[model samples]
Target: SLVPLLKGLKPKWRDSLYYHYFEFPSYHMVAKHFGIRTSRYKLIRFYQFDEWEFYDLEQDPDELSNRYGDPKHAKTIAGLKRQLDGLRTAYKDNSDVRAMPIEWRKKYRPGRE
Candidate 1:
């Protein structure tokens, strides 16, 4: 269902290696195959100015909880990080945008100074 929907949403042509590999079913497919139902996909998110968050998709579909720094969900966070890392490696995505220097953002957002 969502697999076909996601595949259909993909662009016909992806010019970048990373983008191209994303076309192949991976994490999303694996999750779907396992029937890991969540109210929303990509529910765990980190914002530029805010911390990470996690949603009890079955309850709070809107993801209003900041479970990032919560000690209770340490295992969940670690597991998710491991899963994300595995997916990245499986896809051969080596980009370190998250590890980029803070100064780099200043270059793009000159007004932030």
Candidate 2:
């Protein structure tokens, strides 16, 4: 791991990181989404909402702009998606958010119609 590299040995580094947040009726009103991030880019899919977001970490580090449908980055986004799928399979994450237990809904998202 990074320990080997830190100790003056070679350690193979990964090219990307995968992230998933799947809390519906979220405490902070954040949508459920999954994403993959590399050193230079990040791609997110808000599956339940049918939305996709992408960012160029180099140019838009704040993620102020979404480049998902931008023609110039189509190829890059496609490659990232493939890598994301691979990560999902490797991690055995189905990328589906199961329903929260009813009691949790009452605790976390109470008083909603």
Candidate 3:
């Protein structure tokens, strides 16, 4: 159950972990796999370290989250990096998936950042 999985987690840990690893990606993958689209702007945006990210799953499903700049989630972010790397290597995804420049202020908005 969710409780067992999230046991012993601090409230903030639970919030970030669930949001990054489970809730957001789950929603993104299911929607894209079925070709479902929403009018409410389904972009996933997060600030990890210092930079911001914007992912449009209609274009990229494998890359569901941006963990480039968030130090708070460093370990979680690193694990995700390894996971993504393995998946990419397994599928022979040679395309450079490295972070690219984005209008941080515009995409994630100022107050939110």
Candidate 4:
């Protein structure tokens, strides 16, 4: 089941610690969800709800509040979104991602498509 890695290919192994998923079954539901995490942040997007939730580990260590849509975190949020897009592209996890591209996801609102 391991591609690019055979019985003795242990040394070339790489870590998939940065990977994230569409939360299968949950992704097909009325409210689709996709999440991504890096060392300093965690971002979750609720597709049907057009909501985004993100936390900054450096500032809010307790995660008591989400900084998403907060003006202070705009740049950070954009950067994270780009990373998430790259991950999804590399993994080819979903076929319809282009319909809801990362750029559109960033601009989406509850009232808008």
Candidate 5:
């Protein structure tokens, strides 16, 4: 946790962070996605849409361009994908939609008809 760092304990710095967002195209029309952020790169995966995005923070801080399948960043993307999987396993996030509350499914899920 950041508590140690916040308390001035000089904890080892973290090189990356993991995030998962499960909000469908509900209120803001933002799709559900997950990502990992490092100091130099950010990778996002929109699972339901089968889409992926990667960005070089130094070059594209605004995240306008996607480098997910770029040949130049192939190795980097592979490494990030590995790290993403590790993070998911560590956090025990199986990405199971059944874990969401029924009401939440009815309200936030994109299609319910």
Candidate 6:
């Protein structure tokens, strides 16, 4: 299923791909990891450990360094976070819904962005 779809995907037709997976039967902490990727950058967020990572794909294709929490990328991190949040919201993601203040979400929930 995935192979056929992915092989036929046009390079310009998409902006990013986000992936999430959870382990069952053998592990409980696996739910904490997920990744987001764009042509230019990739970021992985690990919730349980509060660990987040960033990579400038163009500059470091091999992914030898971890740029998370780096001051130079704070703006990038903020921007990507907004995008990730938007994607989650669109899919009716409610994992973090309770963590948001009702009034705050109402102010910027939709077209406001």
Best by TM-score: 2
lDDT of 1 by residue, 1-113 (tens): 46765777754542212111122135443111111122232224222212245545555566576455768767766666565555557777664324224574355435653
Candidate 6, residues 12-111: lDDT per residue as tens digits? Answer: 4568777654452244534345677899988876543345779999999998898976899899878888878777677665553222344643453334
* Model 5 poorest 10 in a row by lDDT: 97-106
- Stretches of model 4 off by over 4 angstroms after superposition: 1-31, 95-113
TM-score of each: 0.44, 0.78, 0.29, 0.57, 0.77, 0.61
Q: Which ranges of candidate 3 are over 4 A from the true structure?
A: 1-68, 96-113
Q: Whole-model lDDT for model 1 versus the true structure?
A: 0.42
Please report the TM-score between candidate 4 and the true structure: 0.57
Residue-pair clashes per candidate, as listed?
0, 0, 5, 0, 0, 0
Off by over 4 Å in 5: 1-9, 97-113
Rank by TM-score, highest first: 2, 5, 6, 4, 1, 3
Q: lDDT: which is higher, 3 or 4? A: 4
lDDT measured at residue 52 in model 1 versus the true structure, 0 to 100: 43
**Residue 101 of candidate 6: its Cα lDDT?**
48
Clashing residue pairs, candidate 2? none
- Name the Cα RMSD for model 1: 12.6
- Give candidate 5's whole-model lDDT: 0.83
Candidate closer to the true structure by TM-score (higher is better), 1 or 3: 1
lDDT of 4 by residue, 77-99 (tens): 89888877877777786644323
Angstrom error of the Cα, residue 34, model 1: value is 21
Superposition TM-score, candidate 3 onto the true structure = 0.29
lDDT, residue 46, candidate 5? 68
Q: Residue 14's C-alpha lDDT in candidate 6?
A: 62
lDDT scores in order: 0.42, 0.83, 0.37, 0.66, 0.83, 0.67
